[model samples]
Target: MKATQALTTALKAELRRAGITYAQLAVHLDLAESSVKRIFSRGELTLARIDQVLALLQLDFVDLAREVAQATPARQALSAEQEAAVVADPHLLLVAICVQAHWTAAQILETYAITHAQLVAALTVLDRLGFIELRAHNRYRLKVDQTFRWRPDGPVMAFFRQHAVPDYFEGGFDGPGEQLALVHGQIAHARAADFHDRLQRLAQDFVHQHVADQVRPAGDKTAYTLVLGMRSWLFEPFRTLLRMPGAAPGIAPRAQARR
Candidate 1:
């Protein structure tokens, strides 16, 4: 339940979802499978090793942190309501946000104000839970896939569905109605799942052709990260409008502008 543990759990799920097995991941990192297993068992990771794994996987620490920060709107608000929710334990909130963005611990601790012992403790919990796997040298990266599904009664599932989304939309929009529409109206769950699956395949292919092609097998160190996912239909209208030539390059007025 510690922040570091939460992060590790998120990382493990992401790695799994990406189809990167422990053995395969060990090969990617140039480490032995047994070493990898031992590191995770101990839940101890050094910052440098963490970096190498993330690099091999084409994930950036800073970008992932920023993505996490941006994904949680509640963290960005300045009002009293926001203050109460976000300030409770910025560290924990930051961890949650990072998990959402699929970031590494190095990314989370860069701006973190907690003590080393606290950070290590958090990471240990995460490692023990199989949320992350440690490198031979004690650095950690996500072991699960980013899109890994949480059990129906898992804390993460409950937290996101119950707290994160509701808090995000509080006083900002029609909540229940919008939720209903999303769950029942525009796109069904099955269709969305299929779309996501296809999207992942496309992303994998793109990375293999474009990003991976640029890297040599001799540890060339050149890499690019590919984030593959779909946005909701809420942006469909804008996406369609943008395709029109000479469309002013911005959002068109809701009423098509006063002629």
Candidate 2:
């Protein structure tokens, strides 16, 4: 069933690549455009219909199967070990983050202090880790799915908490195209969960838009980060003052202060 869906998706992509619209496809297949669209949408095309469509598109079942095989799977979250490997080397972590942000090799080298050799070495490690497939001339293919995520309490987040978070907070968010909001309110648990879901959707939209805009001229692009988060907590001082009378002593929180 999953393979059927994958094949349907690949076929649709091939149709677009071949400039075959639903109207054209319908004309060729002797079906209405709506019917053709429904067949693709539901992945319910009969073998005969599938062959007819493929013939119209000049593709065979083998070709479609190959495309399905090559289609990138949606990556969820990396394993703890993978996250630890990234965190263990700061330079490697930098390269990993750049790739996540859709930075190309030229862009990375132009923006950062990494040398060609260093960048190649980092890409090689990522290839070994299955994060990417290294190609000729230091080019590589991103293996990360659109849904890829860092583990919530993983090493990557720990690094961010230790370093990036502090630097990010230092920003005034007062520049053009920048704004910050700090909202504190009581809410039902269900409502909080709903808000988190919305934030996740927004993050996905941001990522998709970034990928879509890669075709634009580099000069027309600007780097941006959309950080979304939520937590039920309070600053230590506020929590201390709100402690109930005669409650147990407050414990010191572990500090993530840099050495």
Candidate 3:
């Protein structure tokens, strides 16, 4: 990320972590709340303005840099070793996922069977893993950014694909706050890349919404998993029915960028 972008991102996260609303920040900066929101969204703040925000947040440039570094460890990619560590302990993995989702320690304790000590232990593991910076009273900020993703082929993804995916899909789609859409179409192989970008963007939108709704009461929020997928394939049974089995889209190679 560009320096300005990284700084802005870190600034926004600091504000969120501090529970400083845009309205609150606007009062600090002597700007309209709309302008503050725009500055955050578009990252249009100048250096002097960023300094002003930093002063308001009681953070210096070094603090901002540290936040940026923490937010983007390994370019926001986990090592195979790190993934293995997280997947090794089921509880640790659960805690990692919850913390990444911005769940509070109390929420995790209330929602799950984990004891406070167990939760603190899990949090200490995360702190060592650099996924979070443990703070006094168990209040912490996520070290990872909103756009962070687990390795596509890592142990965590493998575990989810083998276990969580099945459970996730078993849910009936006909319910409130639920959707399942399957669309198939043919386009030039090159045009398919466009959809890939859109799916990535949509996934990002979900994370952005998650961040925005953090201010909502924990009881008002529900855990949600978004699965976005696209591919050209004929079912095995349908493949047998296809008179022209030699011709099928997505069979060759997909020009997908790494997430």
Candidate 4:
């Protein structure tokens, strides 16, 4: 499916799971119920209106955009020749490593086992591409606005951390502790599906609530499109991996006892 369509589908599903009727959403947005219905039915809302909804529902646009982008198939598949081109570019490797939550050149070199000159060359290329900026002599920070398209073999963790993870779960929780709380709550209630469902709804409600307030009567209708997409492939695997009895010692009390 197209990125826009995928995002709209995810957003609509989220609204449904929230038990928030169109009328209630309308009231919250201070718009006519019919208009809210039209927006939901059309699955298109102005970015400004979306902002309003996001503020109300406490969702982040960057996260939603990341989800959509990740779920959307690449516009053009990489042929062998194209793949070779990316592989030839040493900077791509540096870009990949910097995309992680917190990484440095020294750490990258140590982890990847590369020489100082090789690391410096890679960082220089990445800096030139605007994918990264030098924070200090050897320190760098990722530019979240930049878009990257590299081979799948080129560090999937960096791709997901820099791109996907930030997009879907942004603002839902501030830290790992908050995320663990949400996950634990879901497990405690035996509602993993519900937890996922609620997350989707939260994103939609946030957009709707915001858009209704910010959008002017004569605003550009075409400019308003809410795109919400998620990458289950990237995250679900990690979730499953972490949930294994061997992964969480405290949580897997039964498994520990059996041992």
Candidate 5:
């Protein structure tokens, strides 16, 4: 993950993203396909040669650097200490969630009541914890990707379980696009895995739709949280009759209304 290696990796990614094959790049660079492959494999191209590649891709060095920066993240799952620091202050926790949603400082200021100084302080702490990369003018870049997730039993999730959960479930869920359901059943392990895979794809589709709806006007959009859960569990009363009274096991299939 050295600087040179990162740049080379980004170059390769750009080529793939643009659907430009090595053979095509060979023609563009006026070199043999094997030679082009060797140069990419070794990542031993001169600055001029790299510039030529960038020209063919219609991208500049800055774009490649940005891609490299994005490809490199502050590893998934923060240490316990980091999670504790985030939950130490409620305002900081709110800011952290906003950052996870890619909210800009100005947008946060417009929506939340936190002071500008407080926001900056929280951003500084996140940068120190390697959760984000703070930049000038209160700008920052999220240091995690879609695969990034909170430690299940970490302090942040514990905080949510103790606080946010109550608030979240307090809703009626009878309103438009809201729902609450509970089901119990048993299924084979392999089918359960397939169920998990489909649930993951549904979650990803929700994410894609969120991104696509970002262009809508604020008035035309309403914030909604989609909580997905699949586990082998039965009602406590029912579980009391099962073999393992203290644990829940197996799975069942449930229908989604709109998904």
Candidate 6:
């Protein structure tokens, strides 16, 4: 999804640089301006159409790919003030979340009750915030990396923890491409660190695959969230049973007493 999004953003940026309007693109492609807009907004353009647009822009797929490679890595975490700005406005916060998911202006407008002007305004605010660069036809380039994350315990995450968490877990995990897993064990500190490193690599791989799958058609895509976490914890019931001073090792206090 990231690749397609990047291509669309690059095309828009090139179009702005070339001062080519959707109407001009329609003329070049012998399509309606609305059709051209739809194509770019949905990012469902075929390779031939993409090439056609690139030809009009005097560029090619390699150029777009290179631009994507150069830009995708620049997306890093937003500063605290920037995040605070987002959480300040409900619409801005919504827009930020949608953009993080690679949602185009059209997608957000279609999916939400936001008007075109409202969405454009949000994009403009994001542009000013350095979260994205607004381009012609209201398209944008993501300023953050694909692996961009909310600051740990930051306002954004605090919001998610308070609201998005319960909503997220409401999923049944029974549908196609859905899953949930839990495992508990005690391990050496070094081994725990190694496990965390592996989880980080796995997250990176998932992000890569997300970009790779952008080639698939929209109909073939389904939004999925992967929540990975690890922590030292015990069931609440087991907590009270923990061994006390001089208690039998690995035995609950009550059980040890009974023995």
Highest TM-score against the true fold, candidate: 3
Ranking by lDDT: 3, 5, 2, 6, 4, 1
TM-score leaderboard ranking? 3, 5, 2, 6, 1, 4
lDDT (0-100) at residue 153 of candidate 1?
48
Model 5: ten consecutive residues of lowest lDDT: 250-259
Instruction: Give a tens-digit lDDT track for model 3, residues 193-227.
Output: 88788878987888888878888776887767788
Two-way lDDT contest, 4 vs 6, winner: 6
For residues 81-100, write the lDDT of model 5, one tens digit per residue.
98999999988889888887
Better of 3 and 4 by lDDT: 3
Q: What is the C-alpha lDDT of each candidate?
A: 0.47, 0.76, 0.79, 0.49, 0.78, 0.75
Residue-wise lDDT of candidate 1 within 177-218, one digit each (tens)? 222112213456577677667766765464345423322342
Candidate 4 local Cα displacement, residue 68, angstroms: 29
- Candidate 2 Cα outliers beyond 4 Å, as residue runs: 1-67, 70-72, 243-259
Best by lDDT: 3
Model 2 Cα lDDT, one tens digit per residue, 1-259: 4977987887776665444688889999999999988999999977898899888866668767766776767567778999899889878999998887767789889989989989999999998888876655665556777678899899999889898887976777777666677666667778777887887787789888886676567788777777776776566677678658445343322211211
TM-score of each: 0.34, 0.68, 0.71, 0.27, 0.69, 0.66
Which has the higher lDDT value, candidate number 1 or candidate number 5? 5
Q: Where's the lowest-lDDT run of ten residues in candidate 4?
A: 250-259
Return whichever of 2 and 4 wins on lDDT. 2
TM-score (C-alpha) between model 6 and the true structure: 0.66
Query: What would the C-alpha RMSD of candidate 5 be, to one decimal place?
Result: 8.2
